[model samples]
Target: MENHNPPQLGNQLCFPLYVIAKEITGLYRPFLDELDITYPQYLVMMVLWEKDGLTVNQIGEKLYLDSGTLTPLLKRLEAKGILIRKRKKEDERVVEIFLQQSGKDLQQKACQIPAKMQEKLNLSSEDLLELKETVQKILNKIQK
Candidate 1:
């Protein structure tokens, strides 16, 4: 005989992950609000910050974001003068993103966020390392 029971939140791994993601993004809210960008937009800016002038497709790949989601985010950042999106001269079909002067300046303001967030979480360096490792393991498994 087969027993059937509905799954509960306590037994589901995804529920906790979802809640944690939401809470963490919430934690970023005030900081990001001051920067005048959402978390997703912040991610895009970070990608560009590390490497300026990346093609849209490359940015999408790095962020694991699709064009549909990335395009609007890029457009919003462009509208805010944080970034500039331009079609490649050699290939009009390809768009590249570059950090504007304002965007570059924003990076200076954004650098403090990591320390602030660490203080907010009140997690020791060791604890943070362990948590990062565990999460990366799970993420690797999911990717695999």
Candidate 2:
């Protein structure tokens, strides 16, 4: 068989994944705008909420971001008064982040986002679970 198909990664699964990720992020834009943050910022905030005082690198690891990205993102959060970055006294080089009162306040207003997202995705609970499991399985396999 000729297998007469395009072989570009951009034309395959990666492309849809990229698009879906971007689109979903965009779908979150309106809601996030209310908080004056972007989706990536929201992800960082969520991580900080669960674990306050995470190191910059730790946040990057969790969000799949790097210093180059985290530096600016963290700065923006700091500027927004949502987070504060400080170097450890002992290390002096390791920057850690802590969410401020405004950040915690943002949480109270964001509590409804999950419900809104559920309605937007329109996926049944079973469908959502299966999708999550499938994606996690793929991620686990790929990480190996």
Local distance difference test, each candidate: 0.94, 0.90
TM-score (all chains, Cα) for each model: 0.95, 0.91
Q: What is the per-residue lDDT of model 2 for residues 9-94, given as tens digits with 9 covering 90 to 100? A: 76687788788888888888889898888888999989988999999999999988899988999999999999999999999989
Best by TM-score: 1
lDDT of 2 at 140: 88
TM-score of 1: 0.95
Score residue 25 of candidate 2 by CA lDDT. 85
